[model samples]
Target chain A: MSESDLEEMFTLAVSVAKEAGQIIRDAFDKEKEVDTKLSAADLVTESDQAVEKIVNTRIMEKFPTHRFIGEETTSESGEKHELTDDPTWIIDPIDGTTNFVNRIQEVSFSLGIMVNKKTVIGVVYAPIKDEMFTARLGKGAYLNGMKLQASKITDLKQAVIITEGGSSRDAKEVEDKVKNIHALITHTRGIRAYGSAAVNLCHVAAGRGQGYVEYGIHIWDFIAGALIAKEAGAVVLDPTGCDLDPLRRRILCACSPEVAKGLSQILTHLDMGCD
Target chain B: MSESDLEEMFTLAVSVAKEAGQIIRDAFDKEKEVDTKLSAADLVTESDQAVEKIVNTRIMEKFPTHRFIGEETTSESGEKHELTDDPTWIIDPIDGTTNFVNRIQEVSFSLGIMVNKKTVIGVVYAPIKDEMFTARLGKGAYLNGMKLQASKITDLKQAVIITEGGSSRDAKEVEDKVKNIHALITHTRGIRAYGSAAVNLCHVAAGRGQGYVEYGIHIWDFIAGALIAKEAGAVVLDPTGCDLDPLRRRILCACSPEVAKGLSQILTHLDMGCD
Candidate 1:
C-alpha cells in the first residue's frame, strides 16, 4: 500500500477507536453485567460485544472488501485465520475486559491494519486518560499528536517493567509467572501489572516504562501496540530474540536495544517453558 | 474531638491535599532529580520534600498544636513514632514516587488526621486521574462528590486484588510475596499491582477492586488510604486478623466481611513468616 493509503487507514482506525472508547465509557457508567467466557477469569461484557459490532460495522462500511478479525467475532474458519497477503483489520474493542468490568480505568480500544502481512496502520485509544497513540508504516509513532520516543535506560536495575498475570490459571503457567516475577523483582527497578496488554505496550512506547513482557497474549491485544512501540523506537521481539510473530502468544518489548538484550538474556537463561 | 472539629479537619485535609498535588504536578513537569534514601527502590525527589513542606506548613498554620509526621520530615524521634492518644497529622506527599518519576500516572498526594490514635479524616489526591478520595469519621468515604462503597463481592474466586512489591527486595520478602501471589492468583478473580498503596486502597474503597495486601509498607503509605477504605465499609486488618496496626508494615484489606475472612484464612494457612 502507498503511504497516503496507510495514512488514511490510520486516520480511520483512530476515529473508530475513539468511537469504541465512547461506547465503553458509557457502558462503564452503568451497572456492568459480566459473564464468564472460558473460565471465571475470562470475562466478557455486553459492552465488549456492542463495541466490537460498532467498530466492525464502521470499518466494513468504509472498506467493504477488507478482511477483519476481532476478539468478539472470529468467524473465519480454517486457514483464513492466518494472515494473508490481502489487507486485514484487527480489532480489540476492549483490551482489558476485566478492568473495564471492574471500572479500573486501565482499559483501551486497540485497532491495527495489516497490508501484505505487515502492520501499516495502528491506533490505541485510552479514554480514561484521553490519550491516543497512532502510527503509520514508515512514519513515526505519536501520543496525543506529539511524537513519542522510548526511554533511554539500558540497565535492567534501572528499568521499570510492566507485565500481567494472564487469564489462565493453569498451574504450570501460574508457577512460571511467579518465578519470572521473583527473578524480575530482584533485578529491575520496579514491576507493574496494569492488567491490560495494550496499555502496557503504550506505556513502553511512550517511554514511561522501559520494558514489557507477557505470555498467553493474543494478536488483537498487542498488534496495534506493538507497531506503535516499534515506531517509537522500541525493540519488539519474541523470546528467542527474533522478529515478533503476531500469531505467537509471548512478547518482550524494550525501549532500548541494550535493555532488550539484558531482558532477553534473563528470560533465555531462566527458560520458563515458552518453547 | 467534636464532630465539627472533625469536619473542619476533613475539609482542611482535602484542600491541603489538592495544593500538595499541584506542587507535585508542577515539579513532575520539570526535570526530576531523585535521591536514594534506604535502597535503590526507596527513591525520594525534590518534589516529595517540597510538597510535604507545603502541606505541613499549611496544616500547622491552621492547627498550631497538632502534631505532624510526614515521610520526608519525621521530626518525632525515638518511640514518638508510635501512634499516641493525641491529635496528629500523617502525610505522604508523594505516595508513589517511583510512579511519579516514571510518569506512570498512579501517584497520589495522601494525608490523614488522627485523634486519640484513630484516623478521623483522610484525603488522597491523584493528579493525573484528577481524582480525590476523602473520608471523615462516621461520615463515610467519598470520591469526588459521590459516596464510595466497597465491592459487594464475597467470593475470593470473583474478587480482584491489589498489591505491591515493596521497596525491600530482601530475598525472604521477595520469596514470600511470590508465594502469596501464586496462592492468590489461583483463588482470586485477578491481581493488580499499581505500585501505589494509596491508589490500590482507594480502588478497593470505590468498589473497583475487592481486596489489597502488602508488607513492608509504612504509616505514610496507607494511613490515609486505610481510613478511606474503612469508612467505605471494608475490613482492614493485619495478617493476624486483628485491627490493623498503623505502625506495622503488613496489611490485608477486603471489601466484604466474608472475603476478609476467606483471605485471612488463606494467609493464616500459608504463614509465610510475617511474624
Candidate 2:
C-alpha cells in the first residue's frame, strides 16, 4: 500500500476503534453473573459481533479488495486465517473480554494492518483508560499523542515483568503457566498480571514495566501491541528466542535484548501450537 | 471522639494525603532499577521519610494528643507500635514500594484514623493514577468524589479476583502464594494483580473486580483501603473467615459474603506475622 493509503487506513482504524470502544464501554457496564448461563453468553457476543460486522463492512467499503480478520468472525465461523501478501486488516474487537465481563479497566480494541505479511499500521486503544497507542512500521510509537519509549533496564533481576493466567483450563496448560509464573517471581523484582495481552504489551511500551511474556494468546490479541512495543524500542520475540511467529500463540517482549534473552532462558516455553 | 472531631481529622487526612501524593508522583517518575545499589536505595527512602516527617509534623501541630503510626517510622525505629484507646492515625508513606522502585503505576499514600480502636476515617491516594479514595465509618466510599460500590457477584465461578505475588521471596511463602494462585485460576473466571494492596482494595470498592486477597502486607498498607472496600458494600475479613484484625499482615476482601466464604474455603492460608 502507498503511504497515503496507509495513512488513510490508520485514520480509519483509529475511528473504527473508537466506535468499537463505545460499544465495549457500554457492554462493560452491563457485564455480570451472566457468565454462568450459556444462553446469556450472547450478552457479550452480541456486542462483539456487532463491532466485528461494522468493522468488516467499513474495511470492505473503503478498500474494496482488502482482506479482513477478526476475533469474533473467526470464532463464529471456525475458519482458519489466510494470511497472504495482500492488504489485510486484523482486529480484536475487545482484547480483554474477561476484564470486560468483570468490569476491569484494562480492556482495549486492537487493530493491525499487514501488507505483504508485514505490519504497516498498528493501533491499540484502551478506551477505559483513554490510552491510544499507535505506530507505523519504522516510526516510533505514541500514547495519547506523546512519544513512548520502553524502560532502559537491561538486567532481568531488576525488571518487573507483566504476564497473565490466561483463560485456559487445561490441566497441563495451567501447570506450565504456573511454573513460568514461579520462575518470573523468583527471578525478577516482581511479576504483574493485567489479564490482557494487548494491554500488557502497551504497558511495556509505555515504560510502566520492563518486560512482558505470555502463553496462549491469539494473533488478534497481540499483533498490534507487538508492533507498538517494537516501535517503542522493545524486543518482540518467540519465547524460545526465535523469530516471533504470530500464529504460535505465545510471545516474549522486553525493553532490551539482554532482558529478552534472560526471560526466554527462564521460561518453560509452552508449545500452544499455531493459530 | 465527637463527630466534629472525626470530620476535622478526615479533612486533615485527605489534605495530608494529597501533599504526600505530590512528592510520591514526582519521585515515581525518577524511579529506576536503583535496587542494586545501597546508595540508590535512598532515592525511595528519602521520599518516604520526607513524606512521613511532613505528615507527622502536621498531625502534631493540629492534634498534639493524637497518637501516630507509620511504616517509615516503624521501619526506622525498629520499635513495635503502642496501640491504645487514644485516637491514632495510621499511615503508609508509600505502599507498593516495589512498584515505586520499578516505576510501575500502582504506588499510593494511605492513611486511616482509629478512635477507641475503631476506624472512623480512611483515605488512599494513588498519585500516578490521580485516584483519591475516601470513606467514613458509616457513610459510603467515594473515588474522586464519585460514589463507589463493589461488584454484586456472589458465585466464585462467575467472579474475577485480584491478588498479588507480593514482595516476599521466602521459599515456603512463595510456594504457598503460588498454590493459592493456582486455586484462584481454577475456581474464578480470572485473576488480576495490580501490585499494590491499597490500589487493589480501591479497585474492589469501585466495582472494577469482585474480590482482592493478599498476604504479607502491613496494616498501614491496607487499613485505609479495607475501610474503603467495606464502605463500598464489600466484605472484609481475615483469610480464614474471621473478623479482620487490623494488625494482621494478611487480608481477604470480597464483594459478597458468599464469595468471601467460597474463597476462604479453597486455599493455603499464609501466616505473615502481625504488625
Winning candidate number (lDDT): 2
Tens digits of lDDT, candidate 2, A111-212:
998999998888999989888999999989999989999999899977899998888777788889989988988888788998789999999999989999
Candidate 2, residue B225: CA error in Å? 0.3
For candidate 1, chain B by itself scores a TM value of 0.94
Q: What share of the reference contacts survives in each candidate?
A: 0.61, 0.61
Q: Return the TM-scores of chain A for each candidate in numbered order.
A: 0.94, 0.95
Which stretches of candidate 1 lie above 4 Å from their native place?
A75-80, A268-275, B75-80, B268-275
Local accuracy of candidate 2 as per-residue lDDT tens digits, B199-256: 9999999998899999988889899999999999999999999999888889999999
How does residue A142 of candidate 2 score in lDDT?
A: 96
Best by DockQ: 1
- Model 2: DockQ score: 0.58
Candidate 1 chain B weakest ten by summed lDDT: B266-275
